[model samples]
Target: MAEVATSASSSANSSARSVSLLVVVDPVARRLDGESVRIAKDVLSAGASHTKVCLPDDPEEFARALGRRGSRRPVVIGDDSALLRAVALLHRRRELAGCALSVVPVGSALGLARSLGLPTGAVAAARAVLDGAERRLDLLVDDSDGVVLGTVGIPPVPAPVPVRAEAGSGPQGAASVRPWLRTCQSLVRTLASSRTARTAVAPGTPGPARLRVEVDGVTLVDLDQPVEGVSVTPGAAGVAVVEVRPLSVGAQASPLTASGRTVTVSGAHFRYRADAVVSGPVGTRTWVAREGAWGLTLPAE
Candidate 1:
């Protein structure tokens, strides 16, 4: 009888103290910085009671690995895109509510992770994964079933062009042109084209999009006014902060701002940048803030 009681107590204690983790190392992250990935893996393996490491070579494999995590705490060692992919997968599976995620920021693009207050250093981030607190965070879900952890930007930002000219184009063995000179040339060309491109119908070159912006069923900006851009960010208490900037006429008009749980934008096709990804030329879209919808592990304050 005493032996049985002792075994029961020992089993209970072991179960209570056990920590199992699933570490997913993104391929891009490994290619970008193998050392950081190694450090993160080492730290997490040593700290966790049991750790299962997975090196996914592609996005499909990455999704499959995370989907099979089972009951283990999922830890991602990758960049902003990888983290977003992981969150998106879980959200799609309807498992976010029950899963708390940890990340060791390892890619060149760490802006989103930094904005979320995640540790950037591999060692620190991994340590936090081992000994950290889970905090519920707000999420923005769009009509198309996309999730945004940070801000949504309208008229998506353009990608940077390569400064160096392609080889074999310049004179044989000629030295490469200076990047600043190329930038100035590009700017001059853009300005010249803009002037020529302006028409009587549209005052500005690359005319502003006519979008209807609504917040919580209240119309803030209509199609009558051309807007330069629109931005939406998830705020506390299940609200989203929205802003619509009108195209500058003779004098710049102050942006229209509102706060609501739902934000809808519709009109001529337009593209938007959500966190790091640029998506769609959709005619309409809506986003709602889900406060405390998901959990993330961060360093304890």
Candidate 2:
């Protein structure tokens, strides 16, 4: 009996220490200081039996690195954008639901990751990748074949896409050094204030936009009424909670709310932010909720 117990214990230890990991570090994560990323690498390496590391700079390289993952579990090291890219790639291949994904959040935009119950600290998130539970989570898929693991809001607040540009172009270009547009706007605001003796517009004040919002084919709001914004959030039981808040202040009626598997919005040209990406200026778009569409490894209990 004692010999049998010892053999079982040894087998369990070996299984625990022999986890194979394909650790793909995003370029953005590498661009940051080495301390956080170094800590994550050291932790994963110490725990896993075999760890293959890849530093992918762009979407193509990122996909290729993941494609060559073989049989090892994939552990992504980056912020929310990096995580979303991995999910998007897997979903495009129709392999997201079947594959368990882990994340080690390591960038400035980690709200989505932390909101999904991932560990915030590097060491904790990395360790969770090894000793965590794989939970099947819900996601929103749009008509355009895009996926959203977080909130989707109309009025088009898009996250920055990861792309490389020349030394003086893209987001860090010389043109971005000063807020020239903002300064001009401030001057205009001051002149308008002097002429009209009124304060500048407060934030959250809506502009005149109208939309027809429908959930499960039921119209919640029509174009007759002006709207400030419309939004959809993941809710219980594979349903998305849809709302259209009246942008106008005087017509303070209750915001229209509905929950359904499908939410559609149509009207004047509009765009929506899905996860980290901003989608179209289309006339209309519909999003469908899929239950257990993907798997995310998070801290146990």
Candidate 3:
């Protein structure tokens, strides 16, 4: 039986040597020094016997690449936006339950990543992906097919539109023409553009849209008053935590909380921000909180 034992040993060695890893880097997340890509490749090389690196131009192409690596874990090298894109794709395909999501944050707008306790630097994030433990987390899915992991809200003002102005304007004009300045101007414009409807507002003044919310088939709030925004946490299952802030107070006041698996919201046309993406202005939509939909690696407690 020496021949049979030798053959089995050879097969085991081949199987051990066949472990492969794929690193999906987002072009937008590429660092100034191009070090994020380098670190990702280096980590994968050191951690696995076989590893491949890929740069996806956008979310669609990223999803396509992910589809090709069936059953192989994906390591995303980007900020929260990129992470959200990956989660959305996995959720859409109903593959989230089986895949372990890894992220290496490499952008300024990484609030969600921070919230999840992911490392800010490329090397630390890479090391986490290589050695971190997986934990199941909740994912929020809205009726418009929007997915959110952290917080989602509808700001009072609409998003800004970029405008180009001639150079050599006055100092004030030049200052106003800057991108951040233009964004502020857009916020002001939105506030000025808000229309007041007698039915939608209280007697004193114009206000936010009044919305009706239902949780798990139970009506939590009827059309009581204008609500500044609604926030939900999908992480808490059987508990649909809802927060309502009024425009007068803005996001200052404490939010309302409820518990359920399904939540339905009805109100005037307002854009929805899921994670970081502005999704829709549908008058009504429902959100279902699915438990244990995906796994993520976080810093050890």
Candidate 4:
């Protein structure tokens, strides 16, 4: 399959004289700290003459920049978050079918990027952007129009609290912070102040909301039970896999799988984490597996 995709991409490239490229850089990527950005800029400039770089801080700006690119292929320069952002933008615009996407991991939260086998450094990643082969990938589109490319969940751990210190505090004061300490701190603060704490319906909670899930018009899991979380993922031969993890203390962990093109999830209002960001408190959401929706460049094994 990889060979076939590569051949097709080569064929497509042969007929095209010039390729327009867009480099969307997320300023916050950890590697983009001053010096790294310079190195990346130099490498990218050397590779493609028509490349245009833009830094978009938020989703709205990212989408707008992509829209302006028209037909050029987009290369995202950031970590998994930036990659996901690019995919979401393309999916929302219905342009995923036409554009090929590439990524350069540049942040601490680059787990997904590594999982996809993307290059961790700037120069190697830039070379991949220029010479890599393209392969079509599945995208999970939620009913609420949100798109994700990774696992989603509502974690059981309580959010962390922010530590307040006086001005002029030295390194000793901040030495205990972990890699995701800021995110943990924010989540803790949110949980404490929120009037209604939204938690997964697990062993300690009230109970799981009764959910009515249908896959390609067929009813699957319909029960009133405590659920830790729900996820919809892509499966073999372009199917939408659905799973529900029940709330239990160390019960066996199993994810439900389904093969279908469309999935509809409807139940009581609840918040859902899509990719890495919390998306909703929606009552009903639907997801469709858009097979071959977009193209990505993965590292050669």
- On TM-score, the stronger of 1 and 3 is 1
Error of 1 at 93 (Å): 0.6
**On a 0 to 1 TM-score scale, where does candidate 3 land against the true structure?**
0.74
Name the regions of candidate 4 deviating beyond 4 angstroms: 1-19, 30-32, 56-61, 154-209, 247-255
lDDT by residue for model 1 (1-301), tens = 0000011133344543258888888987876677888898877766666778888888988988899888889999998999999999999999998999999999778889999999999899998997889999998999988999999988776444334443454533134666888878799868865765564222222447899999999999999999888999989988999999999999979998999999999997777889878887788999999999899999999
lDDT tens digits, residues 1-301, model 3?
A: 0000011133344443334566777766663225665676666556655556677766677878777766567877777778888888888888888888888887557888988888887777777876778888877778767777876665333333335343545432222367777777788855755643232332223346678888888876667766767777775653456776654553465556777788888876555666666655567878888787789876555
Total backbone collisions for each predicted model: 0, 1, 2, 3
Query: What TM-scores do the predictions have?
Result: 0.80, 0.79, 0.74, 0.72
Q: Candidate 2 lDDT, tens digit per residue, 1-301? A: 0000011133344655667888888887776534787798878877777777887778788899887777888999998989999999999998897789999998778989988999989989988998898999888898889888989887755344332223454333223324665566668866854654342222222365788989999899899988878889888779999888886566566887889999998987766677667666788988999988889999999
Native-to-model Cα distance after best TM-score fit, residue 227 in candidate 3, in Å: 1.9
Q: Sort by lDDT, best first: what order?
A: 1, 2, 3, 4
Which tens-of-lDDT digit does each residue in 1-301 have in candidate 4? 0000011134344543365577776756622343555566556655554567777666677667778776667777786778887887777778778888888777657767876678888788877777778878776777667776765443222322235333334332333445476667778756755634563432113445566677899876665665666677776567777777665657675655566888877776655666667655667777788777778976554
Stretches of candidate 2 off by over 4 Å are 1-16, 158-206, 249-251
Candidate 1 clash figure, as a count: 0
RMSD of 2: 9.1
Q: In model 3, where do residues sit more than 4 Å from their true spots?
A: 1-19, 31-33, 156-207, 246-255
Which structure among the candidates has the greatest TM-score?
1
For each candidate, the alpha-carbon lDDT, in order, equals: 0.82, 0.78, 0.67, 0.65
lDDT at position 21, candidate 3: 61
